[model samples]
Target: MASGASTKEPAAAPAATAVPDPKMPPPEKPADVRRRSYVILSFWLIVLLLGLPIWWMTTTIYRANLPLDGMIDWADGKACRPVFPLQISIQADALQPQEAQHLVRLIQHAIDDLNDFSGHHLRLQLAPKDDRRIVQKDNPELALTVRLKAGEATTASLDPHSAALDITYPSNAIPSPTSTSSPLATYIANELRSTFSEEQSIISYLLSTSSMSSDVRPQSLTPTDLAELDKRMTRSLRYAATYHLTFSLFADGSTPNTWDIEEAVEKYMRPLLDVLSPIHNFTVDTQLQLYATPGVQSQVLHKEDLASFINAAEWPLSPSIGGAPTVNFVIFAGNQTIALGDSESSAETSQSWLIPQWGTVYLLSLPDATSHVSSNILRQPMLTFGGHLLTLLGTPQAGSLPLRLSALTRIRSADLLLRSSSTLGSLARLSRSLPSISIPRTVADGVATSMYHLERACSNLGGLEGLMHARIAEEEAERAFFEKSMVGQLYFPDEHKVAVYLPLLGPVGVPLVLGLIKELKQWSKKRKEKAKEAREKKQQ
Candidate 1:
């Protein structure tokens, strides 16, 4: 009866639970509970404040911000559309301004009708009477100057020494104000077209091969024509700031060992070199290799033999000791004559065959006793070398020397523009494909500089300004794409993070987790005890 009365509502019910659950190990001492809580808090504090930061600092890679969208635009040909607007000046000092302007208008109309490629445009400007100059200091767009004079017949002749055309027309051939199509104007247009036909073809060829929009590319290039142009393009060496010209004389026998090559070069090659100095800087070095046998021993060198003619093992034609590409011009003194047993236009005969992109091999037949090759004897060879050199430099087949050189400048600018664009595109694609790849600051700087120069180049496509910028763009793009630091992280990847962090995380994590669990259980038990005590106090 007394136990039942007390059991009705024991006010100290919470105190009875002070022992905690029997299944739970035991009620921890206050000091022990506080110590375990401190331990767990310390572990978490270290993980959040110290450990995480250290891990990030050690494991994170440096990634510089890049112009990824701009790079993509350039790669896809949406950034720049290359165009060559060739400016030609027409000089007509004898006629009135109005008459000459009319003639110019007619000639321009004829030219426009003839031109098909939109990328290559020929703009004609009438020259001022006081100063008839080919090129002004401020205007570098003058490709060719045409001088018009009245004579007995319409005649046009190119200035062999300079980029000028002297055209004489009959007095009656001069266009009247009322005439829409004058014979004189038509003749001049035909002559000008004839002069620039080669340049137009080459530019058309370049646009066709490039990764440009179809709107700018030539639409009329036949498969055969494309193949021929491609072959010629392949035979030309890649553009460089400097070219090492190695002139090596290989003699099968002891005779003809010494050549007056330096003098010959000065006389024959210097002028041409000076002309080309703007586009390319050339370093000339001559070597004499006696008792050197060419790979082809047979007298009559077939087309197949011309390929293996240069003895790479024996000749000291190793690349020049620099970054510049080497163009080896080897002259081998032998008694062999090329066998032309089949058919050929007799006027197109030659004793020299150009080894594509490498150099030219001229087989000169010298007297057996002669130990020295005179400058006179080397005349034909030097001239042959000059022609081949132009071809090797990707000059068009038909054009005056000055015109060809001028055209070459434009061609090279276009070529470099396409090349740098392709390189940038490749780098952009690489970055997109490899998201985990680390990029160094240097590479980002290089890419930025390259894009900057490329923009400048695109702005000045025809002038020398464009060529210089395009060159810089190419070099920078190459450096950025081949950056060594960017390649290292390719070996280490995201999956590697699991292996690296797991070893340290697994061992340290288990004890910290268990401590946290124990601390939380104590906290939960204390919270329940406080609530029950509050209820009993209220009931009493």
Candidate 2:
């Protein structure tokens, strides 16, 4: 029994000896603890002083300041008011200088009383008695010249060729020096007002269509006049500095594909193009299309069919590669005739039809054997095209080519000015509506440039320089309004930014936070010990 107990005790001792008591680590030295503290503090300082700033700088987005108030003012049509001053010269070769001057004063008063629009004013001046010409050849700015002649009954007629009104008045109908009102003077005033009535309506229409105040709007437009004006405005193309005019000859078969368009354009259209060069530039290009089909298959096209005659899908009438608009003039060699019966369709009884804002299409009936067209065959077509081009350009129908071109400059300038103002207003409203959209420096610069040009354009209205300045303003406004960088930032939100930054910052931040906490605990322990020692010393 003793031997068995000894053996069991030895086994228990071996088992207890198999696992020794756990070893304990020695307390850290002061130098090593200080070193650890310094390392942790240095890392925190680096992160706080350098790393934080660098990360903030890299992650931040730059937003440039814009002129919101000024842009809004321009867009609201509150910044500039347009005015047109028309100068009329009265030439009374048959009367004395004093008499003509007196008549002019009376007529001016009558015109002023009849005028309703403040923006358009008419100033009358007496032409020199020595000048026999109806219109002052030296003064191109004269809107009209009145020529007085002695005749049977009081009559006034506008010269067909010049901007002159011929008035045949009886010798007894002349205004006396002391007479406050005369039949001759009243008649002349009425005639002058009648002559400018269309112009006034047109100008008033422009102002009303813009963002200007309604107080100055004219209410004299009849329903018929409004309908006509709407049709004309809708038919006219948008104002552009340049237009691409493409003359294409299309045929159902291969015959009569090519035409002598280049020569015809130079002979018939070159003079008009040169006259319009100051207002707009036109680029000419010609192409021959074979085996092309019209949009309508009817042999006899009705008045309603004219609208859908052109095949827009298959036709290569894309806008010019540059920023200019395209005007396509097509000549189709087909035997289609226009069905003409109603009086309403009489205006389109000819073989050609005008496509508003686009070009014209003339159906030229030719023999099946005809291949290449000569310049003579294209003469009438070119002439018709020239007239249609003027209409497409928004030229007044009543004026001569030169006069129409001058009117076109003023019209284009006003139109572009209004368009730019409207665009600026749109942009201002967009910015205000979307506060989160990031505006870059380029957009701000563009807005500044646009406003500068707009001010210049407003001051120089009714001149070639005004048109050029308005064009620049329009381009800049478009660029700033459609800025890509500003639009891109609107789609991304703050959550996306956090999702991208959290993974990278989390891994690096945990160890730093743990080290800082450990250092703070050590510092607290040392401070308590030092305070306890100082209190004990004081007690002793």
Residue 291 in candidate 1, Cα distance off native in Å = 2.1
- Tens-digit per-residue lDDT, 1-540, candidate 1: 665565456576454546665585776688987887887898899999999999899877878888888887887778988778888888898899999999999999988887777777788888988765434654765788899988998899998877789999888888789988988887888898888766767677877676654357564877887888889999999999899888878898787778999989999998999989989999999999889988889777666667787888878785865888888888889876565544332333347888888888888888778899999998888988888888899987665788778888888998898888888888888888888788889999999999999999988888788899999999999999889888776687668888887998888999888878877887898999999999999999
lDDT of 2 by residue, 397-492 (tens): 865555556566767777788788888888888888877677888888888998999999988776677779999999999898889988787778
lDDT scores of the candidates, listed in order: 0.84, 0.81
Candidate 1: misplaced stretches above 4 Å? 1-26, 138-141, 217-219, 342-350, 525-540
Clashes of each: 0, 0
Q: What's the TM for model 2?
A: 0.84
Q: Using TM-score, give the best candidate's number.
A: 1
To one decimal, what is the Cα RMSD in angstroms of model 1 from the true structure? 8.3
- Alpha-carbon RMSD, each predicted model: 8.3, 5.4
Could you estimate the TM-score for every candidate?
A: 0.88, 0.84
